[model samples]
Target: MKVSMGVHQLKMEGPYLTALRESNDIREDAAALQARMEEDGYIFIRGFHDRNQVQQARSEILNQLHQSGRLAPDADPEAGLVGPDNKSAFLGGTNTDKPAFLELVNSPRVMNFFTNYLGGAAATYDYKWLRAIATGGSTDAHYDIVYMGRGTPNLYTLWTPVGDTPIEMGTLAILLGSHRWEHVRSTYGQMDVDRDRTEGSFSRDPLELIEKYGGRWATSDFEAGDAIFFGMFTMHSSTVNVTNRIRISCDTRYQLASEPVDGRWIGKKPRAHETALEAPLKTMAEAKKEWGLA
Candidate 1:
C-alpha cells in the first residue's frame, strides 16, 4: 500500500520553507526558526561542518574505541565497529580529549539549530544510548520519548551521520508530516502496548497506513556533517544495514523547557476509540450513549 498526500498537504510553508532560503540564517532568528520547524515535522541543517572536520572527528571516535579494547574481534579493524552494546558505543570518549562524538554534539552549529526549536530554557544534550549496530541491526517504528522519561515531549531528535549514508546504506526515513499530536494520542490510545515498549521491540501493526491516503515519505542522502532533525512524535524507522560498510551517526534528543509529565508513549491503549468502535458489541441503548450513533 502507498500512503499518498495531496499537493497542499505536502507543500512546505512557514519557517520550514523560509529556512531553506539561501538569504536567511536560521540561527539569527530563533522564533521564526522554531515556528517553521514546528510547522513541519523536520528541518535539515546544511553544512554544519567541513568535510575535513568531520573526518577528524570520525578518526578520533574510531581511535578511542580501539585503545579501550572495546572493538569486537570480528569487527573490521579499520572501520572501528561499535558493537550492539550500548555501553561500548559511549566509550568513544575514553580515548581522545574531544572525540568526534563529543564534538558533533557540542558543535555551535548544532546548538544554534536546536536552540531555535527547543528554546533557551529547554534541556539539551546527548545520551549514552547511541550505540553501533551490527550488520542487520534495525529499529521498529516508535517515538524517542519512550526511552527518556515521559514529559510533554516538546523535544526533537537530531541524527548526524558521520559517514556517507546512501539510500542503500541505510539512512533514516520518516513519515514526514506525521507529527500530529491529535493523531499521535489517538493512535497510541488504540494500541495495547503502553510506555513499557522497548526500543528494540516496539512496533505498531498498522504498517499499511503509512502508504494509505495521501501521505508523504522522504529520505535523505546524508553527508558527514548534515543533520536530520525530527520531532519525537514523528513515526520513523530504518532499513537494516546491509552494506559491508559500518554506519556511524549520533542521535540527540531535544525538548521544551517545561515538558509536561505524562508517562504515555507512542503506543498506549486506545480506550476512547476502542470504546466507540466496540459499540456494535453493546445493546442499541448503550451504544447510543457510547458512540452517539443512535
Candidate 2:
C-alpha cells in the first residue's frame, strides 16, 4: 500500500513499514504488554477507547474550530474541512484547553488503561494537546524525551485519533526498535529541547531514516478508539495527509504521580515558551563558566 507523507510517497511494503503487532492481551497480560513495549518500543491498542466517546470529542473540537472560523464553513463538522484560504499548516495549541477535549483526554477509560497498564496510578500532564494536521503538514521524526525530559524519564505518551483516521489522513507511525538504538539515544535523546537549539528530530525524511537507521516505519489505518502508547525515548513521526479534510488527533503524557512533573504543561495555562531553537541560547560568559573556560 502506498501512502502520502508531506508530499512524499511511501510504499507500505519493504523498507517503508509493515503492520505493527497488536497487543490483544494487554488487558489480561500487563507483563506481556510491558515486554512488547520494551522490545518493540511501542504498543498499539486497538479499540481501547469507546468509539462513541471519541466521536463526541471530535464533534466538539470541530464545532469549536468552525466557530473560530478556522474550519471551512461549507464542510461537514465531522469532515474537519479547511478552506483553500487556509494553509495546510492549520493547527492551534488552544484546542486542548477546551472542556470537550479535556474530557476526552481525562476520560476514565483512558485513565484506567494507564493505571492498569502501569500497575499504579498515572498522572497526566494537564496540557492535553490536540492537532488538526492539514494536508501537507506532518510531524517530523523525533523522540518525545527531548521535548519534555525535564520530568521523569519514564514518561509515556498516549496518542488517540479523534476520529476514524484512514491511511490517507496521515496517522502517526513508529520507527521499529528505535528505543534500542543506544548510539542515537545517548546522543540525540540526551539533548533537551529547552536546553539545546535543535529541532528534536532525527530526520523528516522517512526514506533517509530507513536507509540510515535500519528500521522500517510502521503505521495503520486507525479507528477512532485506537490508541498507541510509547515511552519517552521512542522515535516516531506522522505520515502526510493527502486528503483535503484535516485529520484530528490528541496526545497526552502520563507518568507515576510520585514522579516529578514538568511544570510547563501541567498548570492552568502553560507559560509562553521559546521555540526549541531559541530556548537553548546562552551568553559567552555563562557558557564559559559552565565549561570552566575562565
Candidate 3:
C-alpha cells in the first residue's frame, strides 16, 4: 500500500497572486454569494463549460492511457474498451499537464467567486493531482481536511466533475449542514482510518451514518465547465458508478484569510485542539464585514 501525499505547496504564486488580487470583477455580488453559501452549504452555477470541450478532455485522457498500454484489454467489450465500463483504465494529475487541464481549473468564474469568499486574501495552498478510478461503488465518506489539517477561519474545496453527473449515481454527495465540522465533531465522533481507506477506496460507516442521521444526500450535476466549491471540512462522498459510463473529476483546495501553520501541511493524525479557522465562526463579525453588497 503506497501512500503519496500530494504537492504540499501553492501553485499560483507571485504574478498569479497579483493577477488574482487585481481581478475584482470575478465576483458580481460578494455578500449575496456568501449568504447563499451559508444557507445551502453549497452554491451551484451551471453551463460554465461547453459540451464539446468536455468530450475532448474525456477522449484525450482515454487515448493517452490506451497508447501507453496502461489501458487493459477486454475492458469494454462493446466499445472495444478493456473491461466493462473500461475498468482497466484511469488517468489523473501525473498523466496530464496543467495547461491541458485548464478546463478543470483556471476558470475566471471559479477563481473570482472563491477569491471573494477568501476576502481577496487567499493564496493557492495545495492541489490534488486528478485521479480516475474504475467504474464501481468504490468511494467512501470523508472530509477534505482529513489530509490537510483544517486551518484558518475558512478552508474550501473546488470539485469539478469532468462530465454530467448522474442524479443519485456516482457523483459527489455532500452532507448539507456538515460545513461546520466543529458543530458535529462531538455528535458523530471521529474514527481511526487506514491509509488504504484514505486513498481511492471507501469506508463502511459513511453510509451507516447517513442512514442513522436521517441526513439527505445531494449530488452535483455540473456541466463540463461548472465547478462545485465547498468547505474543506464538509462531509462528502461519491456514489457508486452503477451506470455503464466513466466518471471523471478533479479538485483543488484554498484557504481564506487564515495563516498556514508553520508553513507546513498538517495531516489527519494527531488532531489539533483548535484550528486557525475560528475567525469566521463569529456570526456578528462575519455578518458585519462589508462585502460591498449594497
Candidate 4:
C-alpha cells in the first residue's frame, strides 16, 4: 500500500516506508521497553488508553468545534466535517483547558504509564497541542527537540489519536531510528524554534530525508485508544488529510518530574513560542547551508 506524506508517495513496505512495530506486549516491562525505545526511537502502543474515554473526549472536542462554527452545520456532530469557509482548520495550542481533554491527558492510565516508563514520577507540559486537521492539511517533517528542547534532554512526546484515524484521515509518520542520527542531532537538533525565529519544520518534502538519510518512514492505522511515544530527537511528520472528516489528535510532552521543565509550556497560560512574525523568518535551507548539510 502507498500513502501520501506531504505530497510524497511512500510505499508501505519498502526502504521508503513501513508499518510501525507495536510494543504493547512489553509495555509493563520497563527495562525491555527502554531497550526497545533505544533501538526503535519510538514505541507504538495499541489500546494504550480506555477506548470509551477516548471516544468521550472526541465527542466533547467535536461538539466544541461545532459550537464554534468550525464544523459543517449540515453534518452530524460526531462526523467532524469541517465547514467550507473555516480557514483556520488547524487548532494548535488552543482549547487545552477543556475538561474532557484534561481528563484524558492527565488520566491515571496515561500518567502512570509515563511514571513507570521513566522510573519516577512523570511531569507533562501544561500546554496540549490539539490539532483538528481538515482535508488537504498536513504537517511537515521535523524533530520535536527543535520546538521544545530548552529543558531536559530526556523529554518524550506522546501522540494520541482522539478518534479512529485511518491513513486517509492522516496520522503521524516517524523516520525509523532517526533519534540516533548524530549529524542531525549536532546540527538540526540543536535548533530552538523560538530562539532562532524560524519555521519549525526541517523539510516539507519527506522524500528529501530518505534520500539523504537511510531510513524508512513508519506509521500505523491509529485507533482512538492507540498512542505513539518517542524521545525529543525523533523525526516525524503527518500524512495529508484526504478525507472530508477532520482528523483530531493531540501531542503532549512528558519527562521525569525531577528534571527541569521548559518554561514556555509550564504555566496556566504557557507562553508558547513567540510566533508573532516580527522579522523575516529564517528558512531551514539557510540553516542547513550554514550547518554544511545543504
Q: How badly does each model clash, as a count of residue pairs?
A: 14, 1, 11, 0
> Each model's C-alpha lDDT?
0.50, 0.77, 0.48, 0.87
Q: Give the per-residue lDDT of model 2 (tens digit) for 1-294.
A: 787764477777756777777886665687888888899999898887888888888888788777776678887777788766665433434445466667777888888878877889988887666787776778888888877888799899998888889878888999897899887777777776566655555566777766766888889999988989899888899888878787888778898888888777777677524564454554433432443332
Which sections of candidate 1 miss by over 4 Å? Answer: 1-32, 64-98, 187-207, 211-214, 256-294
**Considering summed lDDT, which 10 consecutive residues are worst modelled in model 2?**
285-294
Error of 4 at 95 (Å): 3.6
Q: Write the per-residue lDDT of candidate 4 for residues 170-233, one digit (tens) a residue.
A: 9999998789899999999998877887777898988889889878888889988999999989
Q: How many backbone clashes does candidate 3 have?
A: 11
Tell me model 3's lDDT, rounded to 2 decimals: 0.48
- Where is model 3 more than 4 Å wrong at Cα? 1-27, 49-56, 68-98, 150-153, 180-183, 186-207, 261-294
Per-residue lDDT tens digits of candidate 1, residues 126-232?
A: 34234444455455555565444345556667776776665445566565566764544344422332332212222432233344322344555567767667776
lDDT of 2 at 289: 44
Alpha carbon lDDT of residue 46, candidate 1?
A: 62
Model 1 collision count? 14
Candidate 2: which stretches are off by over 4 Å?
A: 88-97, 275-294
**Backbone clashes in model 4, listed as residue pairs:** none
